[model samples]
Target chain A: MAQNASQLEHFGRALVDLGLINEELVVLDPDVAASTKVTYFAERFPERFIRIGISEQDMIGVAAGLAASGKTPVACGFAMFVACRSWEQISSSVARPELNVKIVGSHSGLSPNADGDSHQTYGDVAVMRVIPDMKVVVPADAPEAVEALGAIVDTPGPAYLRLARGATPVAYTEGCEFTLGRANVMRDGSDASVIANGVMVPIALEAAGSLAREGISVKVVDMHTVKPLDTDAIVKAAAETGAIVTAEEHSVIGGLGSAVAETLVEKRPTPMERVGIMDRFGESSRSYSALMAKMGLTSDAIEEAVRETMRRK
Target chain B: MLRTINKNQVLILTNIPRVPASITSVLRGISRRHKIPLSTLKRNAQILKEFNLIAYGDPPNFSGVELTELGRFISNLTVGEEPTVHGNMVQTRSGFRPLGTVIKDLRKTVLRMIAEAGSGHLGASLSAVDILAILYMIKMKHDPKNPSWKDRDRFVLSKGHAAPALYAVLSEAGYISPDRLMTLREIGSQLQGHPDMEIPGVDASTGSLGQGLSIGVGMALASKMDGSGSRTYVLLGDGELNEGQIWEAALTAAHHGLDNLTAIVDRNGYQLTGRTEEIKAMDPLADKWRSFGWEAMEADGNDPASILDALNACDLTTGKPSVIIAMTTKGKGISFMEGNKYSRKTPDAQELKRALKELT
Candidate 1:
């Protein structure tokens, strides 16, 4: 299967088109109208949607109340508050009780290249992963975003749906199947598994492609659900692939790398290297690629890291 | 498992001196019927008993409820004091307050709570203390003893950082035990240095600065959807006003015409880093409310009496939600803390001891 139309609007339109979600699904936000690109959904279902100005905390609180009363609320806000400011409510009111609220945190994980370090989310994944029973899904590109949204039609419990800014390159094929906590093996190889999520998915996939030419068949796993790290896949990859590399656009402390390593170390120890921001705030001026490269997030970096892990193999 | 306030006396309303001649036989007839369940009859007999329009029988099979002299008194009063010619009126025994001395107590409790904790948001708490005090004390009909009492008024501390004052007032009002006041900010305590509804007095756990009011608005709308008359009140910090979410809630409140909702903005002139003007200035504050279609009012937050009066007055507005901008002094007591620009600094114990010297 392949996933296409890598845009948030595409996902939103699919939600309405599939009727898997009610048109009554709301969009409550804290002032990121243009960034998440929900204007089209807002236009079609104005009554169902709301631009909740800039009160991120109240937006989540009110959304929780609305969710309690049976209306599905898709609260949109900056990744920081959707992760930080209203952190308690997300943990207590929404996730603790297992309320059916979908928190759409757009511009997540260093998506704000120019908005400066203040807007960049260095560790959005870690903040949410600690919340018990939370289902965190970080889409690799617009295609995966659409698939994740379409996939959660009947899914339950509190979920963190992380989306990035536009110009995201497509990484998955049309009709690509997305599952919660289950990693999809994008590439099959025994040399190593370059497990990746969010914007780094394509980077890892591209690295695998580059390595393939050099006769190093690297298995790429798009580990979208970072919290419940796909242990079965990582364990299997380690058992068969002999080596691994994990990458993300988040702090190395509690992001995808930690999630993968925790699983592998307990189940099956595999030589691995994590490619991410290491104890540093993000740079504001650099383009997405330049910033990622500077922070050692390039496909070249993943290839090199994978090569280093292969040495252990 | 919960013991109610002791019903030692029966309050008799005797203004309707006698039973009408037409209802006399009905009263006599009710007095002869001994098999009726008491709770069902008590709810229906309020007005009838007040006017002597109805009377109670000797005794029922249920041994749980006893008949007393007060019960006899309640059986004779008429229920027409509600000033309506309607067929019937359902009134709660513990209904809404009318704004007065109760607010004064609520306000005082907030201050006392802060002083007890020795660490808190004095500026925001002082800013909202009076309005919130008025609400718990005079405006809302709530059971402090049973904070989760079904159908009771809902109060949300949206500007959550002001939990110290809120906890203080709730404890003073008997919603929380006075003993728990000392446990604030301590590890494993229900008082988590913020408003946690898991705590007896709090309705929503808020401390992230700008999230409580919307929860209040949702609770308000929920009550309305159920067609229940329970009102919801929320207190928001002025610093929280800068968060765009407040406006979203404000607009949503107006769109719904949540007449059962009342919001109080603690319009003190300070935030965490600096004075509101130096941080993010919001002038024409009242005009902004007016544009949002909310019936806005300005009141002195420190003056208990005025705050009580203003909250009571909110009900007079025709078909709209209201926001009361309470003008207050930051760090408003114990002269040294009063108007203290550095609102967040922990006053030295020796310095605080010095500040309290004038208290006696």
Candidate 2:
């Protein structure tokens, strides 16, 4: 877990482990087995792996059907397509009746940088969070992704796990407990707080360290679960820190920023700033870091948002 | 009412008081009791006779309406007793019933239940009744008492408007009570407007079109993975073929060599707006399935025996999925409802009475 690794690889290994433990486990992919990392599962359990060939709608429907037949289906697809193409199926067939279908969306956020804007998904969290009975989880790194995959399988309803495209900075040195609808505070401070999800968690931690060195201590909270947003942690962070800044690799419109704002406005209002893509689509970038910089998703942006929130406070 | 409940029976209701209850006498009694005209009742009775309920003799002959023994039994059957709707003597040791008899019983139950619900997809229900009957009673290996049996064959009704048909068939197979059939779309009822998995014997929940085939594929894949001999059957509407997801599922099933999966398209010709031809002409449907790598065949959807035969004849050894293009008529048994513009609408009291008569 200390080494940077592909979240998709962790997902694939988790699926195989889940299949070995539970005989009712089935995996589905929409022609991205290699990229989504379900190839490992398919190789280990060939009979339980189903490849639907780039049809997200069919894959979701099949997953729902398999879940109805008492099999827990872990469907893998690109975040850009699965969150948009088969949203209706995911809503009607799976979430509506609350089936036990786990959706692992690889290439989440701007991680699929080289594939251009069309491949990079920045609205998956927004779309998936709005669906009723859907549990949305954004792991901090590969270790959390594996833990979240196991948690999703154990949870009894529809769940969506947003995964990164390539190797992400490891945030945990060992496998840690990942409970659905819970947040883990990585650093504690009373000056200001930086709440982030997915790939932004490691950057937020770095920003917290930078703020600490500058004598402006900031708390860092990894709010991986987005749907059942950790309202308790958000409120606690606001009350303790007196200021808050939210960062995510997704758009600021309806992603982590909006979720934190919505929670704070009702429970504990606090001065806040959001760090994400403001209001435009992504463009082709040479590297993930380049896209992160272009979209203002770096640790510097989080530090700037925290400074802005502190000045407002 | 009793004769309508049992299509093969002929019991008459009259307004006139008499010793032996005749068809005209029963009509006279009803007219007198309801304070309506004997002429009006006579007209309604004439309509019933045209529905083939009452065999007519010469005019003015009170003996024209014949009361068969079956009709008498139907009229006298009470709620507490075990009732037989159709006259039969043979009891199969293997519990196999004649498909024709099952179809008739299923039709009778569906017509009565839909009429009781007062609002349902009558045309689609009637159109798919025979197919469901064949699947549940003849073709599929299912145990009604043990709905969750691991090795049982699965059926998903992608064309969920025919839920009444499935409910009636499930009732006949003892998965549901005959009395529960009347609560078709009521709140908190196990039988929903579409096939919900909460209902016993319903393998999956489906109402939105083109989703059942994928579910069937999933079940087939799961069964194959489990090394079970169970098969999966999906019933689809012809109009539902317009959905792109169906073809996606078709490709998946074929690519996976899901030979245990079988799909049946109920080509009932009509959809909500108009005929399938006018909406979307899917004429080369069998060839399309074949091109998609399935063993495709066509059968008379209204004939349960033919459906069973076609289902049996499907080649699962070909390492491809099987599809049956079942040519059926919307509103199959009811004469006035067949291909009518208002076929999907619920029948009024008079229409229900007419349908019941024809069904009897």
Candidate 3:
């Protein structure tokens, strides 16, 4: 098994690799290349890297410009700033034009725990998902993040890549297939299903393991792609399991839970519960794990939500 | 009197086939048969009536237009050929037309289009018409026939409300048919109220303010990286400078040393609602750009000669972006409409007629 690594670092490395293959690949940074770990790409391919300073809006605009000129530009910044501060630029300059620009927003959700609510972004996926022609991807681990980056890079259009700051358990092998908009069934069961993305996928697997010991069968799915959502997988899980629990490291309002619920209410109408931030902001905490535990983003929380959903079912 | 008329007007006159035909029926017949927009037919009909080459049915039972004897003679004379004149301006192919003639026709076309569309930025479009005319007709190295040519220069209309001006210039340059200009802001038309990339010759899609310079910077950067040697030009409104992103883009263009990019601020001194200074002071604008590491220059934005000089001067700069703070009247050409109050107002038919007369 590959050693667990920070998704941000993996993304940086994958970007450099992508630059090696795609000559047109360029990187734009809003003064967070080191924190976002795109410094690796900046160092390797200096000409292709644009240091856009502290202006996230300008970074997106410049990225859109580059994309319009036939270059695939990956704009890297903190999730809070890139996804929120420059939302309109992403909408008007990039998404509306359907340009091939990849916006990699690092330090997503509670991953930037010590930075508190100001830096922690729990609504990146929600804001990005709403833009037309914007593909939203939240990879489960470092390996998956690398794969997701490759997929978005290969696909020609606007896309938002949500990445966590800290390292988590590696969820996939080195060469695991990462098809965009297709969910991966991590573990299968019969009673209910736990659909999760980003940092919550591994926790969901752990929760399914605990449920297995209790003989309460549960299915764990890694729904990495938030937009162009795998509605087929969601509907099948809802129909086959009859109950669903959505887990993510974001707000329950417009993140994975809301997405799954929206799909179910329209397609299958299954009983469900959401395990995520309860529409509130994050604050400073001791560590990443402590913040996750404090925010009810763990195996225990997912297990409880799954059981509650099954009881309703 | 061999008055100027475009090929479309010629088509309308010759296609009448008979006198005493209702203007509506003649327009519908020509529109359906030739796939011309009814709006174009209607506007051309009005123009024909104004020139005394056609007469509409009398009021109370007015229905359509009929070509007068003069209209018949002129149409017969110009059959199977381009119109020899377009509103007192000698008509010629896009690249070959004189700058003055192009600017005059573009101004008239812009007013007529806005009047037909019923709503648009008349003042802003008129203010930028000469600048757009100079760029498309003389300065910018672009191919209307091959708009997507990789090595061709690029233009981004950042002040997108001025789309009427850009569309007029584009049609004059042969990027779009003159008839398509009537479809401005109509549903399903390529000529949107704001510039969209779906329109041929529009390099970057822009509408929201202050975003075009960055797009221009990106295109310039890409051109530099690929060694394409293509230049990029962006037209921004002075009022649009209130947007912070424009400054952000300003710093970016200079930081990258993008000498191939040029930004022309159509300094008409007003935005919608009021004069730009009263709304938000942007004095020492040229100094502000120079402080941001750009080669700032000024020109009489509404003058074809001055605009040509400024655009030519941009090519002399090295290792830095260039900006031309083109000073211009808000609603240029027409005497009454040349100010802030007319910023977004579409002209009535009477106002359009007066404006066209001023242009001629």
Candidate 4:
């Protein structure tokens, strides 16, 4: 509602842009200055942002109290600390009450390459998905990041937003319509459905083009909303194409791949292979790309996985 | 102003927010079965007004409701004695037991529950036990029958490692099944090593220290904004005070004049490894709080009578947030563990027995 866009780029900037700011808008996080990118907002509008400082578990409860106090608190923290260290609080404090709190996690899904396993969160989405009332969002790129930020802030319930280390391509045009609970179709092909999100999204699209030239048609779907799991799109793809391959920068188990498989099997069984880090921790000695490659997340690897699953179909 | 209750419904109502169901149906049955004039029933409503079941006044609008720091203290007072929203009490005030008996029972039950579970932060639990006991049995105005009641005061155990005392109080207050107390830390029990709000009577899920106080601040601020006259109480451990976030909350409480917000620093001087002084010194503690603009009090945290009196006396501080630096003995009552530092060594049979003898 403010005239200036700079002031509008506040802690609740995304919500303000979407004209979705409400009385329930509460933003909370621990003391990581640069990671959340909330410092810009804090310096500008200090009242809206609550600095909890290095306490993920406490943030959940505090956010819950704010929620109970009739303000919506968007609780945020680092991916590994929240996804792993503070699950009990997340489960009991925010989710159990089904309080209207948004849990926005920065450094999500192996994006913390500068830091190792302690920081490179592999199972954030998976862990969040297990909690009831948790709607998980893994936005594809920077544009999707902005869009997802707007959508999730106004989503009106307990939710988790998985943000990367700003390691995303600007996928969508400056302003394209986006909402939660739906998947975006980047490419249409009948050969196989290569469902991907976060860092793997651009890679999925590139692989789709490369496979197209090689006479292997791969349909790339951006499965950003991981929890309400986009069953209709995935079911349609599985039933029609008969082959599906899922990729994410997370662990193979209980993540995007696992969520997709869970849907496909319950609706229509499709030949599938999950493309992500096979149950293993990342090492400090490897580059991000090398880690991705070693963990079988390369474009060629995804294309090959797609082709192999199609052959099974 | 204690807003007027529904005059018509007050013919038979209870608890201010609830109506006596049996009376409601009988009145309804008379109107429906006997074809009594509805306007005649309005006469009964007038009778309720005469009986003070409902205050005789013009109805107030929602706009009249507003939150203030003073409103927090207003909600905790005995009826008819309140400075605002004055309500006439229908009955004389009920009496509470002597504070000494209350403290004795609270300590016995809390330590026994933890000792039975075989795994708990004994020192932290004992340190915070008196504060928890005072809040529940004396200071806080809440309905144990309705733990999630919207208008009730909120208490956050920021140092949640001391969940044993919290669980015991919740059980004794009838918010949870007492049988569940023995099942703490069991695979499927709601009682974990730390407090989880999923369990009844817990306001927040907290195990990680220092953060619960911030949550308390948010709750207090929100309550003030919404015009909800509910106070917030947060208990932080002496060791937990080592966290920088605790200072953030402490400073904010006073800067904002969250006078309804009260905190108890459980200064038993022990952390997980040793004395907090050995781990990190946070002395000159009361002076620090006073400088932060809080009217701070130092209490014998082990004395529930002192705790009860000190907490009620908080409102007298005037226009500032209050904190009771509750000086306590770690592992109090348990002779072998009392006045000693923490050891990472898990208590074995001998230690447990010694603790049990003193606690029992």
Q: Give the winner by TM-score.
A: 3
Task: State the lDDT of candidate 2 residue by residue for B25-131, as single tens digits.
Answer: 55564555456677876676665556554444545665635323232222223210223312211112223344456666677777777778777788888989888
User: Which tens-of-lDDT digit does each residue in A113-173 have in candidate 1?
Assistant: 8888888888788888888988788988876887787555457667888888656767876
Sorted into a CAPRI-style docking class, model 1 comes out as acceptable
Better of 2 and 4 by DockQ: 2
Q: Residue B167 deviation, candidate 3, in Å? A: 0.8
| DockQ for all candidate structures vs. native | 0.31, 0.42, 0.60, 0.26
Local error of candidate 4 at residue B308 (angstroms): 4.0
Considering only the true interface residues, what is the Cα RMSD of candidate 4 after superposition? 3.7
Ranking by TM-score: 3, 2, 4, 1
Task: State the lDDT at B200 in candidate 1.
Answer: 73
lDDT of 3 by residue, B1-360 (tens): 545777578767756633234778777877876799999988988888899888876578785465565764565445313333222122224323445777888889999898988999999998998888767764565667678888778899999999999989888777889988999989999988998888887888899998998889899999999998688999999999999999999999999899999999999999888989999999999999999999999999976656766776787799999999999998998999989767877788898899899988
For candidate 4, the per-residue lDDT at A241 reads 78
- Look at candidate 1 and tell me the lDDT of residue A258: 90
Instruction: Rank candidates by lDDT, best first.
Output: 3, 2, 4, 1
Instruction: Compare candidates 2 and 3 on DockQ and give the better one.
Output: 3
Model 3: how far is A270 from its true place, Å? 0.6
Q: Candidate 3, TM-score vs. the true structure?
A: 0.86
Computed on alpha carbons, the lDDT of every model, listed in order, comes to: 0.68, 0.80, 0.86, 0.70
lDDT of 4 by residue, B27-144 (tens): 4544564466666655664555454444323345212111123333332333213232112211111222333455555567666676677777776776677678657654565766
Residue B109, model 3: lDDT of 91
| Candidate of highest DockQ | 3
Cα lDDT of model 3 by residue, A35-125, tens digit: 9999999899999989888999988888988888899999989999999899999999998879999999999999888988899898989
